[model samples]
Target: MLGAMSIDLVDLVYRFRKEEKEQHQRIEGVYWVTDLTRCPLKRTYEFKYPELTAKDVFSPVFIMGDLAHRGVESLIKEFFLDAASVEVEGSREVSLPNGRKVIVRGRADAIIDLGDNSKVGVEVKTARADLGIPQQHHIDQVRIYNWLFSLSYSILFYVTPDRVTQFEVRDSVDEEEIIERITSTTYPRYPWECSYCPFSVLCPHKKAHDDRHR
Candidate 1:
């Protein structure tokens, strides 16, 4: 009887692992940034909001204002997806060079069942008017998602509060430029990042660094 019980327990563990894998397959998103860098700024800002010198400029208002905007993005993207969704496959956690885990999280704004003309990934960007149709930076972001998720193609949606702009990625669009831009940053700035940029105030790169003995 004890031997039979051990077998049952092993079977249960196997079933549990299978179920977990299936559940992960059903959800299409990557949480890789978590492994990249430990974002102390977000933690510090949330904790010391009251004592912050820039409290007035940075308020809970930013949070409140984005709620509805985020809602619109969700609704539109879900509609585009119809019902079925894509799932993240591997490397959700990206480890940064500094040995910190920068939690990277992303989902398809919408996944379209293309039938025969199906594309792999779709990205939705909310932005103001007069913005360019598609930039190298935007392409790089989408390409990373597509590559990581094992998707063949990606679509870029630039949506405003009123209108929607769409662009598709193909093979011949100077992909090298996009990759280069992603790898190099000659001019980095603050006050423009969404919430994830790590080098806002404490980055020595923002100032001039002169290394002698070259």
Candidate 2:
């Protein structure tokens, strides 16, 4: 029974991640709104070496996050009714710094209609630590969602082991900034990104801590 359970669990997680990957599959020439949040070079690597980066491994952290997101969405639906929508799909087309146009797509966790011709985008994130409750990448992601959905404001909600908190992002990035960000190749956008990145092994620009200073 243990063996069977293990197989079932593995299969279930794999299928779930596979479906998610397909849903957010990368287009050859287009950019995802998430591209602006992470290391731009990671996306470039994904495009350049699809085979190497395509597989999704089992992760307990990701599974926890998925469950939390589903729970929160369910609660929002129950409480907010028609005023809130979950997994809201949105996209925008912007010209890159190189003069080429591309589509930037993203799905916001939830959007709440204020009934005043204004909407608020919500981005739910699950984290292990409360140290950086509102990480930069998460802030950027919510801002991009605001830009994509033309939302008046965005809320970055974090569910950590210690607490549940949220922050507001009122200002969104413009097309020019988005273009510049998407076109940049800076790897490991944050100093801590490489440690959590799947492509760190093969990434030449992976950031490493200076042990000498330690």
Candidate 3:
């Protein structure tokens, strides 16, 4: 009976130890557009309990996303604006009201020539499945690039294992709102967000799920 109940202890402990250091970083000292959109509580936990919340587990989906991005990025160089045109690091800097420095930057996957003097920014993403066009977080990412470039529009591509979908979003990301969010305190902030957060169990604002559904 004891043997039947036994699980792979080595893998379990490896996973536990591996997760201890993943995504562990200082929050307030720096910021990314994701922190403002992907549940502020996630950022809160990463900052507040960096050790406990880090998850270093291997995710094939994440690996696929990376491979997809790299493949697409290489292809777009020949047809559109080359990789040389984009900045990868947080090279562009924005100064806050309190003299705090924040950098605004992302590796604009590509820039498309509109044939006129104008151009559109591109962001490529790979997801396990199609959530929908303009998924909020990915939108936020591209919108930030648009804001930085002050372009009239941007494109988002979601490549899943099954298919690819594209969306053209207008340059409407609120720079002030983003600034406000980063300055504000971190809480889970939204119940829906908690349902998807890794730190939901430890989150003070995490909503109780209905056991009946389970």
In the order shown, the candidates' Cα RMSDs to the true structure are: 14.5, 3.7, 8.2
Per-residue alpha-carbon lDDT of candidate 3 for residues 1-214, written as tens digits (9 for 90 to 100)? 5766868865765565465334334545566656666666576577677655444345555545655777877777756644224324333566778988886544566776665667677788776566454566677777777776666788887787777878998856676866776676645443356666677666667776542221
Q: Write the per-residue lDDT of candidate 2 for residues 1-214, one digit (tens) a residue.
A: 4565445777787788888877776787777778788888888778777777565445677878888999999998899999999999877888766677788888888999988789998888997778756777788888788788999999988899898998999988888888878777666677777776778878888887632221
| TM-score for each predicted model, relative to the true structure | 0.44, 0.88, 0.69
lDDT tens readout by residue for model 1, 85-114: 643334444454445443334455445555
Q: Sort the candidates on TM-score, descending order.
A: 2, 3, 1
TM-score winner between candidates 1 and 2: 2
**Against the correct fold, how does model 1 do in TM-score?**
0.44
Question: 113, model 2: CA deviation in Å?
Answer: 0.6
- Among these predictions, the greatest TM-score belongs to 2
User: Which regions of candidate 1 fall more than 4 Å away from where they truly are?
Assistant: 1-83, 86-106, 115-119, 161-163, 171-198, 207-214
- Candidate 1 lDDT (Cα, whole model)? 0.46
Ranking by lDDT: 2, 3, 1
Model 1 residue 210 lDDT? Answer: 33
**How does candidate 3 score on lDDT?**
0.63
- Give the whole-model CA lDDT for all candidates, comma-separated: 0.46, 0.81, 0.63
